[model samples]
Target: MKKRTMRWASAGLVLSLFLASLSFVPSGSGNASAATSKSMAALYAQIQNERAAKVVALVNKERAAAGLKPLTVHTNLSKMAKDKAIDMFKNKYFSHTSPLYGSPFDMMDAYNITYRYAGENIAKGQKSAEEVVEDWMNSPGHKANMMNANYNLIGVGYYNGYWVQEFIGK
Candidate 1:
């Protein structure tokens, strides 16, 4: 009971810090909204501009470097993203699911970004999953802040040559 309480307390503290960080955005200012839109547009453009064939080749090259089997590059961006997410989870590298598993919208909200289905609005062309991921990782604002603050807990305890998720086992 005490351990559970401590865990909940820590979670609440982290959440409070996360919310407080948002207060840096001026009240009733449109810049926050506009900045988000611009970031999303950049992401959309990056995804659209990336060639699926080139992305596939890049992924295959990366796999060879990692000594893993190459994935078949498909011209389907959505499918590629899904497969990459699964593969990353399998590798225990990084996981969107690990942070928040409820829904995509919720996850996007936590990350403070807009997410749209490929056919919904801006993203129409198919890009390789790896390319899309690279774009997101390279994004300036939300991605950086999230890594620095909210998700840092998951990253800690893994440093200093220790397995943080030891309870889950290797």
Candidate 2:
């Protein structure tokens, strides 16, 4: 019985060592793979590309509706359309009486207003993303109002028959 116990213990030790050795050794495959994680710049670039693609799709849909060829979408949307858009966003969505400084920006297809910029803010004069979000939050009376209302505003955009939105810090 003692001899049998010793054998079993030895076998267990051998199995554990084999597993530990396997983890320490590099893969047998000759080729190395891309890094599993990306830098902040890479991540931002990827997101920018994704966002641009969505914008393009929405713009193309609008052009098709107008019987025009597909063209690239730019930030330089006509002032009339842009102003009307900002108004529709505030009045129809939030029912705000006063002009909103910044809420999320959005684009809509021809059928109706179906797309938004999700978490992106539309602060008129704020330059950076941080300022756009923070300035709006800390604006005079906004903090108190938002805290009382218990809801942070965000945009909801869509692309290619699917809803797309990004999460931004509150």
Candidate 3:
């Protein structure tokens, strides 16, 4: 029984060593692979930007129907919203407040965004920008943020299945 146990241990050690060594192996494509990865990353960023823009447009349409002025997209606020979405997706939590980043206002402060009035809306599992915006508009709290005349700046972020919208006004 002891000998059998020893053999099993030896086999486990060998397997571990083999797996560890695999990490050191070169992929052969090297710089070409890295360049491709960079290009793919840029393409993905562009797609995400487009999706975010679509969300803004849809939100603006909703506001227009309600006779509210369209909110301009704030770049810093967008960065903050994107960071929140990424944080929520990575940490697997969906809420206006994040364990890592605190509330939306906190995130805005971190991004150096100043506003006298601000609001945030978050959603998950929506397949498209329209769907997510519709979901938000259906919710009273989110709809208020969307239609609030006090808000003059907007930021949107979509990552994976998570969506975040930040609203701000002077």
Q: Specify the highest-lDDT model's number.
A: 3
**lDDT (Cα, tens digit) per residue for candidate 2, span 57-150:** 5434543565545443333232223443346454543322224423333322321333322122233433333333355456645323223222
Per-candidate Cα lDDT values, in order, are 0.37, 0.38, 0.91
**Cα miss at 165, model 2 (Å)?**
18
Report lDDT (Cα) of residue 43, candidate 3.
95
Q: Provide TM-scores for the models.
A: 0.26, 0.23, 0.81
Q: Which residue ranges in model 3 land beyond 4 Å of their true spot?
A: 1-30
Q: What lDDT is reached at residue 142 by model 3?
A: 89
Q: Residue 18 CA error for candidate 2 (Å)?
A: 32
Q: Which regions in candidate 2 have their CA more than 4 angstroms from the true location?
A: 1-38, 73-170
Q: How accurate locally is residue 118 in candidate 3, as Cα lDDT from 0 to 100? A: 97
Ranking by TM-score: 3, 1, 2
Ordering by lDDT: 3, 2, 1
Q: lDDT score, residue 47, model 2? A: 54
**Clashes (candidate 1):** 0
**Candidate 2: worst 10 consecutive residues by lDDT?**
159-168
lDDT for residue 152 in candidate 1, whole number 0-100: 12
